[model samples]
Target: MRVPRFCCFLLLAIAASAYADSEIPFAAFELADSTDFTTNAEKNLWLLAEAAATAGDTAGNTQRASLDLRWEASLNRQWRAGFSDRVDGHFSQDLKQSDSLNTLREAWLSYRLTPQTLFDAGRINTRYGVALGYNPTDFLGRGTVRSASSADPEMLRSNRLGNAMIRVQRFWDRAALSAIWSPKISSKPATSSTSLDWGASNPRNRLLLSGSYRLAENLNPQLLLLQEEQRSPQFGANFSRVLSRQVLVYAEWAGGRQPLAWQEALPRQQWQVRWRNRTAAGVTWTGENQLSLRLEGHYNGLADNSRALAYLSAAAGSGGGQNTTPVVTEWVAPRRAALLQAYWADIFDRYDLNIIWQRDMQRGQNLGFAEVRHHIGPVDLALQWQKVFRLSTHSRVLAQADRRWQLSIGYFF
Candidate 1:
């Protein structure tokens, strides 16, 4: 019996090493095959440049660009190095010249532990989104320089973790857990008004809990519960299945706090449901012009009173990309009470779209957007436009409609 147990342990150790080897090889293969990340072994570097222009009302911004470079070094299967340099050419007419080289996007070690658990400790990039897609809905973007430029972004933890933590993942298992508890935040405020930035985040504990289970063949269910600021984000559930070879369906509903304030961590108390179907994962899985459709609706609990006006007002004046801002700027509250309701109707599968709808306790809002994108060979082209209108206000009557458009061309080799 003792001999048999020892042999089993040895076999398991070998299997774990094999699994680690598999991941690094696939990454390397994709790098060499034309998915980007490939370069001469000596000077392994690549450059990326992007520019966007937007117009609306009496304001228009143009000529925003970024100089991105990546250094890929694979030091065996267990050790890999990646350095990402981002020089922000934030030239939007009024903005100052903002350009600099950032830290290592990924400089870590991947040690196999029992062919399932992986110990990845360093400044690494992580994705909490589904299918690892670029859509913000699939997974939220935390450390994106472009996304943070938004007038009102969520209070988020930095993208990279400084402390050491272990992640044990089993692919295609009945269930899986991907969680992180880190000493990353420097501070913790009591509520939104006292929230701190990622660097100085309240020392209060924060985490994201996501798990999925296989109920049956053609039926997979998933749940995401996050405690960014509040105790736990509202709950969301998703189910996937096949109707036929041509039709697939995904329907999901989520209820949780609004993760806008770091200190107060107000709960939005809203529910959202969406259904989407596409031919395949990437663009054109079956035909030349394969299309995807998606519809999502949200119901926010503003029973306590809608403070969106004040919150947004503070966000507009909020500055400093690396620091946190107070959630409550003015001691003002709306007079009316209503539940916010809105939805999105979307198509154009490639790179998809981001349509946001905002409302108050009494009435709903409608935001408009249109986008077109195509990737031919190694070049990509994209065009997009967005319009937003603030609906039903008690203190402030109504804000002006805002529109933004962007046209971009990118080359990858």
Candidate 2:
């Protein structure tokens, strides 16, 4: 279970940060359901398991299982603390790289410096890792935010070690700036589970700087930028409008650099766009039901290349400050070098679903994927399935799919 230990730790802490409550039945507990905590000594728990067909390479079956504890408590009005712990494992063909499983995800603390300002510095989740919480003010969508870190051995920000410097936030007033510093924590060289392992990945530091501004009573615009030393600079922005009290619409654009021809000497570039809609479907016993529909497309001209950075940039890469990494030639797209993707989703008070399709011109590949999630009481459950029908660059058959299931039980004191 190549579970990133630090990230597992964080998730567990989140699951553990529950308020006291009735104990769950042993049957349900064993089924990997969550159990909320009611006391300081007691904590909530989350368990997840997903079975897959045609996963990875083995051409057989695959599975993922994990347990997490989440918690949140007030030290006082001016101070609050949070803790999360996660433990997970994966199983597949006894391949040395993919066979074993293990990880410990999170451990963090957040303190309020003022009503409008605060500080979070610790082994925190970096902004460069996931797009989910990066919105600064609020995020009304389903599914996790993707990060370049995914191509690295690390799945996402998970745990690792570093400080996260966050500034002011205005959820209701209408503006925000959020920055994160995410660096690879691999003690040794590692390969990504989903990318081509061209040997030890070019380790580097990654940074993200994002801001949101309210331009009109109904419109809000956001700008985000990310840079990885020796690799390339990534820039993106989103414009969201409140169509009504209950309806919100958005447009987003993102671009990343790729190495050029000999310029392959230089990093190539990648780009994507999105249109989104969000609405409310009333509230459940647990939380608000925020629904969203999004259409997105992506293009990558940087896929193939063989240059390595002598060092990666640590400025944004190191977390929030200065950092660096060895330069490595990032992936480059063939002469055609263009990829496109589309997706749609529906979210309701206790359930959500998403559908996606993608096509790559240069590589001549098409892919499809879907995800579903269910929430009950303090318990959150999710199911995800993905299939890639065709790909020209890779040797393995493009037709493949994986099923993933997750459960999280949380309560706050």
lDDT of each: 0.37, 0.34
Mark the regions of model 2 whose C-alpha exceeds 4 Å error after superposition: 1-57, 92-100, 126-174, 179-207, 225-235, 244-248, 254-293, 301-353, 371-384, 389-413
Candidate 1 minimal-lDDT segment of 10 residues: 10-19
1-413: candidate 2 lDDT, tens digit per residue? 01222222222222111110112111212212222221222333334432332343324544444444444555778765555544444555463434422222334556666575656643433332111212211211101221211111122333322232233333436676665554544323333333211122213455667776777764556677767666556676655444444333344455554443223222344322222222111110111222223333333233222221111222234352121112221222122221221211114444545444444444465444444545454344544444432121122222223222223333322
- Candidate 2's TM-score: 0.50
For model 2, what is the alpha-carbon lDDT of residue 276? 22
Residue 300 Cα positional deviation in candidate 2, in Å, after optimal superposition = 3.7
Query: Residue 279 error for model 2, in Å?
Result: 24
- C-alpha RMSD by candidate, in order: 12.3, 12.4
- Among all candidates shown, the one with the greatest TM-score: 1
